[model samples]
Target: MWGVRSGSLVRRRQLARTLRELRVHAGLTIEAAAPLLDFSPSKLSRIENAHQGVDVHVVRSMLDPFDVGGDRWSEILELTREASAKGWWRAYGLDDRGYIPLEAEASTIRDFTVTYVPGLLQTTDYIRALFDASFRRRSEATRERDVTVRKIRQERLTSAERPLELLAVIEEAVLHRPVGGPAVMRAQLARLVEAAALDTVTVQVLPTDVGAHAGIDGAFTVLSFEGLGEPDMGYVEHPMGSTHVEKEEDVTQARLVFDHLRTVAYSPAESVSVIERVAAQM
Candidate 1:
């Protein structure tokens, strides 16, 4: 458990969902509840947005002021307690405060890589080099833990039930990069060729000769979930951190960009040929 558990995030989201339902049932706008709670509208908004955790006392004070029924208050209090419980990821001394919970729930992943292999598909040497290079400033122990977490995350690719559907478009340069030297690069490319054969995995290459592409902006991921429908999310990672974009406008933009990139990328068979050629050169 190196990150927040999926259950905790779902529980927290549920609190907001529940409150919204209650507000709709009561025929009141969020604005009306602000004056009644003696709190700022923004405070209520933050709580409902799942951006802030509500303490037990605070929950009691706020809901009591609203004259919500005793049974309803009890139910909400239980939900709040569930939401506040420490997630399993805490046990591993890793902060899942944001990233883990969201990734754990994604059912389909579409990503474009400009500089390196995507985490889920990376070989051990590539991953080791990636972590070593990434955490150049961290202690050895911290870096090992971080790398181990990434391996655990990759389990989703092989999971029997509800295996993730992954569609990755990687730049040709990624296959040529010798992260851990020539041997590692060859083995990694071989693995990529094999992995591409898997039913759930689709690998495409955007060749350098293609000249221009939509993914020139940088790497991005689109995570889709079952039951959530078409509300795709976009994630952009930087050297220090990653951010999730949930706004419809941003998601739409990411989708359009991905579609364009895919169109320019090599077909699965051609991508395999490119990887095989790279491996043979090594």
Candidate 2:
């Protein structure tokens, strides 16, 4: 459920969060630090809270107050610049609104889905059918646009530099669903089997026989970036909206839930057999 991708992740708060940590470590309060940086209290506050973007020059200046230099200094400044950079999706008129940017930037994704197939693993026909099945209506062009976005995202799975590591756990029901009728679902399931064979992808099935498990709370994802000094992010999507969970406790809990689900789910080989068995029945 890329449900609502237009959440707070557009600026990705790592830069702000890091700055606040540095300021606190420096033993300076917003009031005390504002003058040192030549920023109004509100401006500094906004930057620290991620309400506003800070310039690289301003961020460089901030190092003096915190006595940060060398490697750590370079890291903070790089993070600052990353905060304001535009995503490639922007060129396709998709930007600053949703989980696409974050997904694009993530090096690994732990995806658990209760409804439909995980977007990255969907076949074009399945994607078309899923979009068409939506209760909300849209032009063919918009549906086509979404399909394109999904395809582009899938490219990361085979990228040379850093292929995305995808650990996707889908409820067994996903394989059985007649997403685009029998043919489409069959192809999609076949694709799942093929993808699971890759070194970079792992596909697991949470069988109904598990009865109850940690993932009873619906679907969520845990995304890990390669290295930006940021913690893993937890995302949950529902009908009305979606949420970005960054608090350490919440993300940790999501991780635990996912771990439990993985423990209970079928092994990769068994999962492939399960998909094949299900497809045969259809």
Candidate 3:
């Protein structure tokens, strides 16, 4: 999961410490705690590691095992409340945990991609084609659910507030490859042409002739906010999971790399011509 937001790592650590202390004070090992909660020992371990959260019910049950009283009960209740207050991503789906809320909250998104086309600009046919590639291993119901969720996620790009400013630097090859075949590629490029006209959107293509560029590291998004206290954050995804980096040093380094990439990439007009050229070839 991307690192915790709103709450600090310190708070998570404190909660873990409190859990451990309660367990020890009650003269129980995690093995002893597991049966009472009807959970595995690993479940308790994961909760303590901050890999999972403890709901109010579980916290109440855990407290029952210990002999704590007075303000302690309410304090633990408050902590659990903070932990369980549906993270911003909850509106879409309980399982999406894709950092979508974090991305939506961001004011600007600078993206660089070289593999499949980025999600925001994907046509339904293109998206279905990409989903089908992965659905070979999934059940039909699961595949349908995945496709539906992706379409909902894509809607954020045009939401009423117009909160996000998206600047994409994509490789020429992405536009050239026909995901759902030639006809689908043509429609996808045409959709791109329309999306590029949005006031908050900018598209640039990194041509093959550019030789080399900084984005070769991998696809990444740099999310910046608009406020006195907000800091820029960088997100990187892998097949296994995603990472969110918000430290000043990391954001600064990614900004420098992206700045260099923007310089080497074709201008927006040139990038549109490149797309037209690829579409014509298809």
Q: Which candidate number has the best lDDT?
A: 2
* lDDT for each candidate structure: 0.77, 0.85, 0.75
Model 3 bad stretches (over 4 Å): 1-92, 95-97
**Please, what are the lDDT tens digits per residue for candidate 1 over residues 90-109?**
55586545665556667788
lDDT of 3 by residue, 1-282 (tens): 222232333234456678878888899889988898787999999888767777778888888877767899898777667555554446434433446655645668888888777787888888888877762575667666666766765665676644467889898888888899999989999888888888778998888788767778788889876641356888898877789887899888898888888899998888888888788888
- Arrange candidates by TM-score, descending: 2, 1, 3
Q: Residue 51, candidate 3: how far off, in angstroms?
A: 10
Model 3 TM-score is 0.67
Each model's TM-score, in the order given? 0.80, 0.87, 0.67
Q: In the order shown, what is each candidate's alpha-carbon RMSD? A: 4.0, 4.0, 7.9
Per-residue CA lDDT of candidate 2, range 20-102, in tens?
Answer: 99999999999999999999999999988778877789899999998899999997776666676666677678767578877
The TM-score that candidate 1 achieves is 0.80
